[model samples]
Target chain A: MLKKDPNFTRLKKLGGRGYLGRVSYWLGVDHLLVVEVTNYNERYRRFYFRDLQAVIVQRNRNRMWGNIVAGVIAILPALGALALLSDGEYAGASLVGGILVLIGIFILSNTLRGPMCSVHLRTAVQTQKLANIDRWRRAEFLIETLTPLIQSLQVSAGEAQSPNPATVSNPPAASAVQPDFS
Target chain B: MSTASNNVLNCPNCGKSLSDLPEMLPAVERCPACERQTRVVVFPAFSRPVVKGATAEAVMMEGEATCFYHAKKRAQVPCDECGRFLCAVCDLEVNGRHLCPQCLETGAKKGKVQSLERGRFRWDQVISTLLVLPLISCGFLLPLTSLAALVLVVWKWKSPPSLVHNTRLSLIVCGVLALIEFIGGCAFWWFMLFGSRRY
Candidate 1:
């Protein structure tokens, strides 16, 4: 878990450029400083996993609020009918009352459709966030675990940076040493 | 790392990766892949891990509804009409009142619950009025049948009043039609009885 990540500070400072900027750029913004920050990029794209997770979480939280609002809108027609019916005492009360009840049920069914759709969308986004996080975590683990090996390679290659013909004379000893592992 | 894979070249101006490292940095000490005394920037990756079910916390965070009448714990039963959260004891049965106990009581007191007090007028009343109105205008010696239908329609239409005002107009038209029927019937009867006397 301990990492000497230089870009961590940069990522934290830059934040996950919100969806607005990304969308604006995609919509052909002329002044867009377009940069390809793929999830494959270990620096700039680090926050994407968390951003996706936040989106899913936010959507799920909105579900209950949306459901309550939809439930309220469903019954508005019944209120309207009652107001209209209050005009006459009873000569048409039974008929209007029956119609209002039926209309209320219909409206309730209609309102439920919206929350149901949102619930489905939220569930889908939640699943996508979980999957993306899992992929990013695995890739990050591999890249971090290999950091020492990569640094050692860098050191050896740095010594060989100068391509001198004199240093190239030892090609035979390097080739013969590979057969002595046993 | 030496085969161009480990290190990345960072632009001096913006610190972003410069793919054309040799072109951007002329005095580059090491190859683009190696970070030895090179202008290549090695930026490390940072990850913040979140558990899969983290969003479930948000689901729990949404506020719960409170009962309208009891105002005790959370309420789940939304009123079909007003959308108010009403407890079992508070729920009203009327079509639109769908109220808490307090509102239900108020509605009952105001007689808004059974909006039916204004007498439901049927089409049959107008039909009956039309059938019987003629008897009243013709001065029919016998006033049992048609006269009764007209009287019932008028009284019902007039007393409680119809929810639809058209029912009153319908009764008036029917009454006129019934009167014509009654006058025609009496005139025929008088003609037959007097024609025999003239013969």
Candidate 2:
């Protein structure tokens, strides 16, 4: 077993659905940005913080019509049972209505679930989706955390390429002397 | 190059030696020589040299088991697959099973173990076959088989995908075909009953 690093602090945990999604949360990050995706099998990818260009979140809209149709189908049996109850079939009406109610509840729970989103972490080399973040809220949070960190790293890298402040300060003295000439 | 061989830590920004700095992993520590901040992440495994156990000695003594691969080397463990005596170097541990090179190669070639596989059977293919085969054969049980195929696709929708990537194209095709079959079957039954009453 690989030992956990004490220095590593989990900023946030993005919950995903299914077994592969559950397994991704437990994988160790060893000094590299690891994006793991699991469906039937697990796939792992690593990225350097310096190489990360962007983190994107794309929202996926749920189809309301599909849910509505499913709900209608589920309630049809109960509607039929109500008509039978009016004709004095109490026992049959109660059993059929009870079953349809349970099925309707199941369909309603699925319909009421929040929208899912895809999270993509892009580099110059390749763009990869982080499968563990399925919900839109979690994808937004991850983007918020990573975008700044990458930007800061890029800022530092940019600063390194420019001339040092100590060496460039003497050249600016010439600009200050132009004010005296004016 | 010599400093790298000696494992001397250096500042990435200024290329200044940071051997004297206090060891702190995953933390920004200021380099004393360069006055620059450097983020260091150290893995403990890299700090020490790996120790390999001594190789099996020669089988000079009587009744001592010898390695099948190397006759001069004494056997430490038997191969789990073929029961061949193996030296420490020849023993390969895979999924807790001690296998020789021959068995490992054969197992990989035959696809007996799923460990090396990257792809899997697609459920969509199964559904597609179930829906289309009955229709192609003009079987009387086409309606029932198509219904079963649709039920399977719906039931396994949220199930973990197989090794193959699932586009759900097959599921849609199967569903459409199944729905058509169901509608035709229902219409046929209605016509038979109502038309016969008219006759």
Candidate 3:
């Protein structure tokens, strides 16, 4: 008999781009595993589908902050380039602005990635914040992907608990509506 | 399980109650208290009751063994690690192991429980840094650094490896590079002193 290994396996790379440690998601038969890997340590947090209560996503100002910093960095060089161009020193102007294209790339990419947001998961006693899911699209993707799995698992458990889902007649999670900002 | 687990969805920022606007959820809703924009995804468990935990039962028979901790309660099962008798209240089921409190504590302290491991020191990083630092910054100290790397590879061979990366390959590569660097450094020094003095 061919038997599948009943263990947490690698899943989609759900957003967790940490500065010091990278947090990645894994999937098991009944739970979602969040592993944070640092240079010296590996921390684990598991959220079972049956116990998952809610997913809260909040808008953040990451891109705005990032662009503001990039703008500050680009200012001095931009002024220098303009002064050189006014003096007809095209060589100096190009040289000054050429390297500062790094700021342009940063701003463009950040803007194209869309608005940044933070996703949080709440259970009965614990509310975990996933700072890694910073982008709006990633937050939406995370919620969209997890809703069905959690809903199905809860429905099966509810079936086992009672014959009809009188309590779950109007399951909010089962019919999760997506926000445009997610 | 508590009904709070299923029916409660509060503002993540100000911790204010948003229960009155429950129908407008899974959308961008500004909190009245903090006025910060929030989007909440309510799952099935948001409306479901909390799953109740197993409760301890009274003694079933006169001849039945009593719990080790509780004199009046029935002994339901034996601990997986220590073989101690545990009642319903005392028997903590984790990964199918009906362990007593003491056994669970001991196992956690010793890192015997895989699920309880929070972190591990990456010996691979230590050894790799030892081998590579001198080569990039101080070429003259390469021999000594290589020897230290080699020694660390042998010393921490049985230590816990990195969970994110393949560590055995790193250890092997570090050991090999260290061996070659040490041998090359020794040979170069030997030739510089003796070979140059050839009469």
Query: Largest TM-score belongs to which candidate?
Result: 3
Better of 2 and 3 by DockQ: 3
Best by DockQ: 3
- Candidate 3 lDDT over B37-94, as tens digits, reads 5677776666666656767778877878888999788889998888888888899988
Tens digits of per-residue lDDT for model 3 on A48-128?
887887888777677899999999989999999999999999999999988689789989999998888777898988888
Instruction: Sort the predicted structures by DockQ, highest score first.
Output: 3, 2, 1
List pairs with backbone clashes in candidate 3.
B6-B46
Model 2 scores what on Cα lDDT? 0.54
Q: Encode model 2's per-residue lDDT on B1-199: one tens digit a residue.
A: 0111122344544556544422332233444676543323332211222234456678889888988999888998999989999998788877678888898888866655544433333567677777767767866666677778779878877654542233365567767887887677656667777877987
Query: Model 2 clash tally?
Result: 1
Candidate 2, residue A58: CA error in Å? 2.2
Over A85-109, each residue of candidate 1 has an lDDT whose tens digit, in order, gives 7776564556656765665566555
Runs of candidate 3 with Cα error greater than 4 angstroms are A1-9, A87-89, A163-171, A180-182, B1-6, B21-24, B50-55, B58-62, B109-112, B137-140, B184-199
Docking quality (DockQ) for each candidate: 0.01, 0.03, 0.47
Q: Looking at candidate 1, what is the lDDT of residue B90?
A: 54
Clashes of 3: 1
